[model samples]
Target: MRIQVFAILKDFFKKEFELNAKLYTIADLRTHLSLLNPNATPVLNRCRFAVQDEFVTDEYTLTGNEHIVIIPPSSGG
Candidate 1:
């Protein structure tokens, strides 16, 4: 699956990237990501995920090859 990251996450993750794993849910994706990018785990936890252009909970299951949008909370002055 491809996780499209934006905002600060894009910078952390070096823009968009592909993930290949046996992940079954958003929670699993996050866990897998943490293991792959431990340095960004703190910020990763603050991110929200969306599938099929709609916001979804972490428990949402991924059947495979779903392109997920990773949107992190934006900061402002």
Candidate 2:
């Protein structure tokens, strides 16, 4: 599955990238990413994952996706 990095993550990852991880759920993806990019781990927990344009929770299993979007933390007043 292709994981899409966005916002601050692009900075942490030094540009978007993808992984061929055999992950089952969003949590699994996070774990994989942490190992792949420890520098982003600290803020990863606050990020969001989306598949098929719908935001999914940690437990949300990944069935299929051309690309998964990882939205970083957003701030606003």
Candidate 3:
């Protein structure tokens, strides 16, 4: 699966990364990602995840062609 990142998530990764993983759910993706950057766990826990733009729960099933996006809450003055 190809997952994208924005805001805090983008900052955490700094650049796009690909992993040959067998994840099939949002929770699984989180587990896998946490291994790469343990410090991101907390932020990821509060982040909103999307499948091609539609927000979904952690149990949401992931597909091969789907692109996931993880974004943190945005604030403005």
Candidate 4:
């Protein structure tokens, strides 16, 4: 699956990357990513995932070919 990360996540993953694992749900992908980079777990937990420009829940299923975006909380003045 292809993943695009933003904000602080981009610091860890550098914008985009691909994972070659069998992930069934958004929850699964979250766990897998945490395992890949434990340091990013806290941030990952707070992130909202999006597919096809729509936000998805943890129970959202994945077909393994979707382009996923991981968006973290943002604050501005």
- Judge candidate 3 at residue 41 and give its lDDT: 88
Per-residue CA lDDT of model 2 for 1-77, tens digit only, reads 77678778886774556677688889998888899879889879899888879998999988655478888887757
What TM-score number comes out for model 2? 0.83
Q: List the residue pairs that clash in candidate 1.
A: none
**What's the C-alpha lDDT at position 31 in model 1?**
87
Candidates 1 and 4 compared by lDDT, better number: 4
Residues 1-77, candidate 4, lDDT per residue (tens digit)? 89999879977786888888999999999999999899999999999999999999999999999999998997767
Candidate 3 lDDT, 1-77, residue by residue in tens: 66777776776785555556888888888888888889888888888888766899999987756777787877767
Q: All candidates' lDDT scores?
A: 0.86, 0.81, 0.79, 0.93
Residues 17-55, model 1: lDDT tens digits: 787899999999988888988887988899899998999
Q: Would you list the clashing residue pairs of candidate 2?
A: none
Cα error, residue 16 of model 2, in Å, equals 3.6
Better model by lDDT, 1 or 2?
Answer: 1
- Candidate 1 Cα misplacement greater than 4 A, ranges: none
